[model samples]
Target: MKTIIGNDGARPVNSTKILSPVPPASTLTIDHVSIKIVCQYGKLQMAKISRSSDTAHVTYLTPEGLKEARAELEFLKNEKRAQVADRIQKARELGDVTENAEYDAALDEQTLIENRIIYLEDVLRSAKVISHPSGSDFVVIGSTVKVEMDGEVDEFTIVGKMEANPGKKRISNESPVGQALLGAKFGDVVEVSTPIVRYKVKVLQIK
Candidate 1:
């Protein structure tokens, strides 16, 4: 999921490869074998873009997104944990461990709950809390932007992938349209292209 942008052009590097030479098996007892890896690349070059002072300011997530995330974490900590513990205890009481469907289901539930708790914890830690700033007319990460397309006006808020709900007009900053609108000012026309279509829209307001 690494992204590299440069003046030359962007190209995705897949898994890099390394070759290892085999040693004689007779030289040592082959109880087990392991190898360490190292990588070196020669003189990498890149052109950097100058940052514009007026480039769009982004606020990562809205208060609502933060609240929802908190609620989810609470559910995972309280309700989900309790439910899984109860399932495990009930399964244990059923006896015959090897043939127990309930025990297997309980274990599966435990695995899922633990994984989700880890994910939620990470999300809460990394999430940027967003608030609507006073008197700011420019679009920022969490500011809801109004855009005009052929006389039709639509509003959407820019958000990170975790908080974006496109159906609700909350777009991920990584998305094409979102990227195009990143630094746009009112009355500025920005063109966005996707694999399926192209759109020409004007920035109207940042609320």
Candidate 2:
């Protein structure tokens, strides 16, 4: 398993003292960006870090990614919305809305679902669908890149921040590795620095 020992940005000049994992709600800076982190019992939240230029309304997506998002939105709007509404209606029939536990729970679920629906709607509304820029060899979102780091050969598909899953080798464009490789070509050496560990990443190929 990979590990990261955060640096407090207070290390002596060139000092390499490694910091162990911290408690919940800890804030730190990695790559000059302010990152708010919360870790509970060693389980880290998979945060979707945004690009410096990102706007709340705009989201970049590939065709397949867009399709997936649209499908999820439809499900949430049609199925999940109906499910929660039914639960609320049934709960309301039981007794007072103020004292009913089932009613409260149903309302809470409804709020969460509606919030997500709004977010997805905004994303779809402002989405900028893009393909691999023609004749461009530089790394960009939707590009499959092969990299060598710490003697491990791996390939990663760089996608937008919304679709990045490190476990699946689909890295977010705003992530350390993805950020480093953006606009880089094959045979380029990139540095990936995180609060945990830093490594030299060499680009081998792009597709």
Name the best candidate (by TM-score).
Answer: 2
Per-residue CA lDDT of model 2 for 40-118, tens digit only, reads 3343432323222234455788888899889999999989999989998999899855457897787668767876776
Best by lDDT: 2
Report the lDDT tens digits of candidate 1 across residue range 44-76. 111112223333444365778878878988998
TM-score of each: 0.61, 0.69
Q: Worst ten-residue run, lDDT, model 1?
A: 39-48
Q: Candidate 2's C-alpha lDDT?
A: 0.76
Clashing pairs in 2: 4-196
Candidate 1 regions exceeding 4 Å error are 1-59, 95-99
